[model samples]
Target: MFYFFSLDFSLVVGIFLFFLFIFFFFLFIYFFFFSKLVIMDWEIMSFNGFDIKFTFLFDWVSLSFVSIVLFISTSVIFFSFYYMMGDVFMFRFIFLVFLFVVSMLVVILVPNLIALLLGWDGLGLVSFCLVIYYQNFKSLVSGMITVLANRVGDVMILLSIGWMVSIGGWNYFFFDNFFCCFWVMFCVCLAGMTKSAQFPFCSWLPAAMAAPTPVSALVHSSTLVTAGVHLILRFWLFLSNYSVVVVFLFFVSSVTMFLSGFSALFETDLKKIIALSTLSQLSVMLFAISNGFCLFGLFHLYTHALFKALLFLCAGTIIHCFSHVQDFRSLGFCWSKIPFVMTFMNFSNLALCGFPFLGGFYSKDLVLESFFFSSWSIFFFLFLFFSTVFTVAYSVRLTLYSMFFMEKGFVVDNESDSEFFVVFPIFLLGLGSIFGGSFFFFLFFVDFSEFLLTSFFLKILIFSFFFWGSLLALWLVFMDFSFDKKVFINYFFYYGSSMWNLQFIFSQFFLNFPFFLSFYYLYKLDRGYLELFGGKGILFVFSWLGNFFHYISFKSVLYFFSFLFFFMIFMFI
Candidate 1:
């Protein structure tokens, strides 16, 4: 009470951001030592065999992930300054971005189940809000789907939490009880899948492109999508023991990778293409985790974040400079017009394709080598190879289509001025995309090596996938093949492009069924039976009783007394 003074919120935020930058930036540097440790613990409450606490683990895993998240988030915020410039609700937008960052940090750092759920929900809630921030019908629909998909994961987590109470609090690290652990593992993996947009849950991700591009850069890259990967990484210890769950995750991850790759190959919107690519990458991470190489999975998450963010930012610039044009067919060659955007876009795409020595090369190459060495079925091995090859194929296919092709006399939209604030962030992430993975590998994999059971032929086989995929992509581009009639040609084309009609299935089961049941209950139960018995039927019975007891007349009283006296005489005799 000695002094009344308050710090402005802006100043407080600036200070917080500055502190995080310095602390984590240094942690990023120092983590090369790989001295993992548990750093902090604080008890929040205790009662009746229930315990809750705030604790954090500082390991190479968390440090690496958190560092990248912080770095990408900062870049996104800077880019938003330009993307969201002159908007009336700019402050609200910025605030929501900050909330997203903080919640994601919670997801990354916490070791306890209860605390993790808080972050998980916060990420979902904030992302849904961001998705619908434009307040348009499309955005609303997209946001609803996104939120509902995430809510499925939230319910699974909640069920796990409820089960946790019986086992004493929300610490799942020491989850020894078999029944509890089994169900928890199953639910947790499903929750992770939904958050990561695996398989049937994949629709909402492309739809979430309705949000501003800056939000897309952050959400798709470092925050929302990666949260699922981080959750699985956190539970890797427990997950390793359950072979059934592992097998399930493996197959699911493989299918997701292939479907997303196939879908991305056919996608047209520039941002949607990047979103689908991000979906494919998430599947790659899950596949790595499922294969018991979680270290590599976490590594890929880090590397993917850098380039994926750059890809989105570059897309944002392209779309922004063209007055928000996203249709691939309408775009013209822009290398001469905006050298920076085109250069960085190609760099990110190259990295995405696992170009030699780039960011994606280290993790993806290692994953491929791992897959080659593992004793998987021919189907999995082939799909894994196809997914990897398709990653390159689509990267090449999309880049060449968008930036290298131009029809003469084509009119183009230009807003190079809007690229001013946007280009800087793209440039920064582009640098990371070029060198971030190699840097992490240098430090983290100081002694990294593997012994695959093969000769020169097998080694060449791995490298040949990339080359053949590029050749295929170039062939398609050169042929100028546009399969506009594919949908009409067969039902397979329609089903594949429409994500195997998963949206219809999800809508019917989760939405229409519930609505139908709600209508039935309201009409038949609430209004019909409940109303008849509990409402009108009770009132009629009371009214009839009142009429029977009505009138205290002398004749009525005498009749009642004579009936009672006759009954008493019959009983006594």
Candidate 2:
């Protein structure tokens, strides 16, 4: 088992993943163009009315997503070779990371609810282990938050499974009861929302930055977080039937996007800022899905995964080179030290802002254009508009603070980017960030000419927000307002930085309340009443009864002897 932890093992896994990516990429093309097929129910056995099968789904969606996952996993594992060097538990770390990837694959390729649970639970369990990899208090707490938030989703999925059992079997794809579909969709939406960190579940996404940078690059960017999006997409047919669910999802996603973007603008912790950015982008995916653009949402998912992974990898390089300084405030004038990483980071940041012709542009622009075409109310329009602007604002803020601004801070003289393991994956993902969007857009939508035929004015309206946000952020960042001195401004900063006190709510209400409730139960029930009445009470009653019986037995025996003697004398007489 230890042998699996070596660098050579990583090389082997990377090569295998690359091969799988190639195979699945072509498979996706074939399925998309030539034929669509699903291979189901490689049966194991049958219970009363339920059949357990290792059901595998192989359609264009699964194929394309699998290809992308394998590609990113390959890059991440290779990057980890250099990123996690000389670690004492390198073996355990590698094993857990691989397990994480496999779990994601299982979630992607299975349609059976029971089979999905296997993968779903695998993802939650393995993620908890990975998040707490550092074995510190902070990581443990973060891991707990991350896992518990996801466990809600797991419970929802389990409920959905039970609900599906009422219809016939665990196969959700073949569910026929329209009434049952609504309940399943509701449970699924809750599950997806939790896994994707929508709205109230949003705190864990930023907290999960406690994991190692490579884990963040993989888990946050593509695998763990996106599992929810993928799950919802699988249930899109059911979800589309319920306009109520779609409307609710739209509002939740919009709030999540706005909140995350707002929070990132004030976040100084570099990785948390990126994590918030990820949350915001995830909200964008959910937004598109909720607006009845499943394919568009999926397109964004693929594009975002590419560039976002690139961003995280670039951020990881920056953190690694600087002796793990993760605060953007302490990382000023970074370009002079690490120009390559800064360049890629800026590329990804621009892509994240949906710069024209970049990877994010293809999907993001379409999602916005489609929304504009819809007849939704003006409030949501502005919510989405400001959210997009906030994305650019934070991207510009991060790029300027880290690369251009001059501030007095510690600088590591030994920073180097010469390693092949590190540079190769970054370069690979960089190229993907540059062109992957257009490539996927072409494949996904051969002719988006209908959406493209909108007026030039409408087209430019979306891109214009990029400039507006960048200029706004630029002015704010470069100006000397002494903004912190003012009470109103200070309060705004505090609210923005704290996710509008959502963190406090999650920590106090969600996390602490459960712990306090459990402790109370332990005292009042387990230790107090249950102990007295359950085990101890039973033992005392048994002991007392035994003593009483032992004493009474001697007296009864003497009485019985005297009675027997009298009876025998009477009989003899």
TM-score of each candidate structure, all chains considered together: 0.84, 0.89
lDDT of 2 by residue, 417-439 (tens): 66788788999999988999999
At residue 504, candidate 1 shows an lDDT of 74
Best by TM-score: 2
> lDDT by residue for model 1 over 1-573, one digit each (tens)?
111111133234434664686688688667647564665777789999665679887776787778788788767877776677657677777788889989988888887788888899999999999999999999987898899889999999998888787766676656865567888988999999999999889888988999999899999888998888888888878888899999999999999899888776666688888998999999999998888888789878889999999998888877776667887666767776677788888989988988889999888877777786677989898888888787888788887877787733344444553464566667778888999999878876777464234567776887898898898678656544555635443454466556667767774357777768999999999998998899888998999877765643333988678767888999999
Worst 10 residues of 1 by lDDT: 1-10
Per lDDT, the best of the predicted structures is 2
Pairs clashing within candidate 1 = none
Model 1 / residue 313 / CA error / Å:
0.2
In model 1, the runs with Cα more than 4 Å from the true position are 1-19, 31-34, 45-52, 177-179, 407-420, 449-454, 478-493, 513-573
In model 2, the Cα lDDT at residue 172 comes to 68
Q: After superposition, how far is residue 410 of candidate 2 from its true place, in Å?
A: 2.6
